[model samples]
Target: MNKKILIVEDNKTLAKLIAKKLQSALGLTVDVAYSMAEAKLFIARYTYFIALLDINLPDAPNGEIVDFVTEKNIRTIILSGNIDKEFRKKILKKNIIDYVNKSGVDDINYIIHAIQRLQNNAKHKVLVVDDSRVFRKQMQTMLENLFFQVISVAHGEEAIGMLKSQPDISLVLTDYNMPVMDGLELVIEIRKTYTKNELCILVLSSNEDEEITALFLKHGANDYVKKPFSKEEFSCRINNSIEALENIQMITNYANRDYLTGLYNRRYFFDTINEYIDEVKNSGEKFAIAMIDIDHFKNINDTYGHDTGDKIIIALADILRSSTNPHDIVARFGGEEFCVVLKNINQYSAEEIFNRLREEVEKFSYHLKDDKYINFTVSIGATLFNEEESLEENINAADMLLYNAKKNGRNQVVFQA
Candidate 1:
């Protein structure tokens, strides 16, 4: 998507103010055109991510610029001062994103938020389930217009299967009545596995029965949209649902992550690893659990102060996060101590992995004031998984080896399988 915007407003002062805001706030390229003629030239020269068009312009007075811009396949939003009910209604019918009254700075802020919303919409996928092929296509069109990745199915059963295969799908829009599996049944089936926080479900039906609406909401449907809805209402509901889901996920991530390093916290690691362990435990595969600690960390902190010491810890965490495979787990247990799990590894490979990690930390340089630098080293201890032992035992075994490594010398890896 182009990081550029075209604003066609006749008022020079208002146009420049909005342009400044778009450029400064969004870091986007802004092109302002005072009339339809200039807009045509700009549209011909550059492909814009979105266009803000004025209904009344010097060259085109009767909202002719809107049709011209829309014909160029540019996504448009009207920044018009015209508040006539008939004119607003007619202009909105064009495939434009929105109509914002150019009343004050408040409207400019809304435009900024709307652009941010559109950019985020691309991250979500919406599943549309309707028995009528026509309705399915209509919903698909509207969703795509709002920049959402859309998947359409003819019935509710296919919707379930799609969710299973594509669990990352963020929202489901289903018609209440369908063959094989009705929308209500689909909602119940979906709630069996996914929570409202995990997935959003909205029912779309022509039926206005209040009892039916209550039943759908009672059975895990986030919302119900009646058929023949306006584009503004539909857009608002979908955006709000996605934004809510994003907020919930942000909070969940904050809870499970370390504050400074942004790695998985100790609690999250232990809490989530059991299911993975169960899956691979009986596969006759060997795994390595290791304890890593910054050697003489207290001395460094004492000499450099706690702030620099925190910097070193953060640097080491970055190394661990990047050096390991994506499937491998790395966590900060607290202070200068860290833990790593090398999945599906052999005895020799595990030792080599830990040794490489030790070398990486030893060579890293943490710079201080002037040209001075602090070189740090780490101690590592690793143990292979034992079929008969609990996870705690394996961790204890590794911790003991870490102790031995520090005892023998401060910068070494002690491996015991």
Candidate 2:
């Protein structure tokens, strides 16, 4: 489908010219609006992929149109003739995707480039935490306009719940002044739970004092946007922050995930288990550890090539990942073996889970190079942690039970007493 672009220029001649040029040059359907009212009407009627906005429209001066465009979140380029540093700074301060000084020649190319970049870039998800319905809705509209998936919560507590539930959230935009836990308090709480590498947070405040901004940044805020910001400026800042987060996440994934099976690597698994152990020690919550091995895996690898063995491992990883909860830690434990750690699970529930997983593996099938397919089962040993016992003792008990399960039968679940 052809992408849509909205041109919000008050000059009838300029609007028509830009609209025609964009339509002819890029094959975009360009909607021309001469006033903010007309622009709002257009926006209400049709969703544009990108919007070219003039900040100084007759109806709303001081770039009110920028706010409206941002609230709508369509990728925006500000075409402003006002070159004053303060005015430019203010206009660029909100979530406008780009700013083009209209005074220059052939700067229309900048809008084209900005639109192209926005289209090619990945759509990011932002969680907006604010108690104000008006602000939440406003931010939601703006983010959606830019093709971002937005999850909005009315309060900081709700935001925490959202973050815990959705680990794939790309960024968080939180209002600093809110009821039911203020922004700074929320940031500290979230930081305690999720490391800086796991999540990125940005604080929004009406108070723009340098000292206050510094404080917010110190308390794990990736960035801060003062209230009454420009749409173009806000977009630039948001993009910058998201880019930084993407780089960090890429590095983190490389360091923490296993390459072949796409499961948590040994180091990450140990780090996570240690954290769980600490929590269990403090809170007396139950936890369970399981050791799993594909039955006759070595024979299969010897019969078929190692490539086929690798495929089987990858398939098993997929099955395990699908069977467990996101909070459960699953890891490739070298060779053809895997491990699962379920936090807050009692002995009975842990045995049941191990049995289910074992049954699933027995029923799972895989295909090889010549359309040759094979089915296999897994043997599992599980042990629940008793607060009286040490972490290593629990793991060792599980491992011993696993060996017994393999000895008794190739595909079964064994639980230690």
TM for every model, in the order presented, reads 0.92, 0.64
In candidate 2, what are the lDDT values of residues 122-227, reduced to their tens digit? 4566899988899999888777656678999988899889888987787889988888888988999988977667778988889867988888889888888888
Which ranges of candidate 2 are over 4 A from the true structure? 1-140, 149-195, 198-209, 225-229, 282-285, 346-348
lDDT of 1: 0.91
Encode model 1's per-residue lDDT on 36-105: one tens digit a residue: 9999899889999899998889889988998898888778899988888888888888888899998999
| Every candidate's lDDT | 0.91, 0.82
The candidate that wins on lDDT is 1
Runs in model 1 lying further than 4 Å from the true structure: 279-285, 299-305, 366-374
Worst ten-residue run, lDDT, model 1? Answer: 272-281
For candidate 2, the TM-score is: 0.64
Best by TM-score: 1
